[model samples]
Target: MAYTVGEMARRLGVPASTIRYYDKEGLLPFVGRSSGGIRVFTEKDFEWLRIIECLKKTGMSLKDIREYIELAMQGDETIARRLALFRKQRTVLETRMAELQQTMDTLDYKCWFYETAAAHGSTEGISDLPDEALPEALRPVRERLRAAAEAETEEV
Candidate 1:
């Protein structure tokens, strides 16, 4: 079934302007134009939009995504190249995920630390607590924070 740009945008949970911008950027080349100049999207266009959204969320730049789409348009002969591109992007995404996980772990540790402090009247006795009182993973982070504080005090 053919869908107008607004209908497609509503179905996809994106703004109509986003769909129009992607169409202008040639990202939705599979979508056809009506005789009256309205964008007419097929089910295939929805599938293409899903791929575009995934790539965008994975931090792929517009130019690179456009190149990937061009490769796709070149037919089965470009299958190897497309596979290679996806593999490279997968590696990038894995690295990013790892970094984000590490950041989240640190944030979780900090949250626990602050909550402990808040439980007491003040933060005065936090450092005096034993490492066993905190999560095992947070030991090194706390040590680093303590060393930095000591160094700052010494410098002053």
Candidate 2:
């Protein structure tokens, strides 16, 4: 079913101005216009919008997104190019996820550290505690943090 730009924006959970901005940026080439020249979106357009949102989440620039859209408009010949783009994006996202996981691990270790210290009423000797004193899952994180601190100390 055809939907007006406002209807499409509401359904997509974006502002109407965002939909208009996407159209202005040439990202909504698949969108049609009504007899009165108002933007009209179809179900297929919703699918495209979802893809655009996915790419945006991957930190893709609007220029790259526009290129991807243009390549998509070129039909089966661009299939390989699209696959390469997605593969590259997947790798980038994987690296980001790994880094975020490491950060979360560090945060988890810190939470445990502070909670333990708070229970003891002092941070004294906490950092010097044996690895066996830490939760098994946090042992590696503690080691990593220690190694990082040692490296910084040596650098200074």
Which candidate has the top score in TM-score? 2
- Per lDDT, the best of the predicted structures is 2
Task: Show where candidate 2 strays beyond 4 Å.
Answer: none
Reference-based lDDT, residue 88, model 2? 87
lDDT of 2 by residue, 1-156 (tens): 999888888988989998899889999998898988988889999999989988989988889889899999999999999889888889989999999999999999999999999999999999999989999999999989989999999999
- True-vs-predicted CA distance for residue 110, candidate 1, Å: 1.2
Q: lDDT for every model?
A: 0.86, 0.92
All candidates: TM-score: 0.87, 0.94
Model 1 lDDT tens row, 85-156: 888889899999998987787797779878999998678988689999988888887886778799999999
Which pairs clash in the backbone of model 2?
none
Model 1 bad stretches (over 4 Å): 143-156
In model 2, where is the ten-residue run with the lowest total lDDT? 59-68
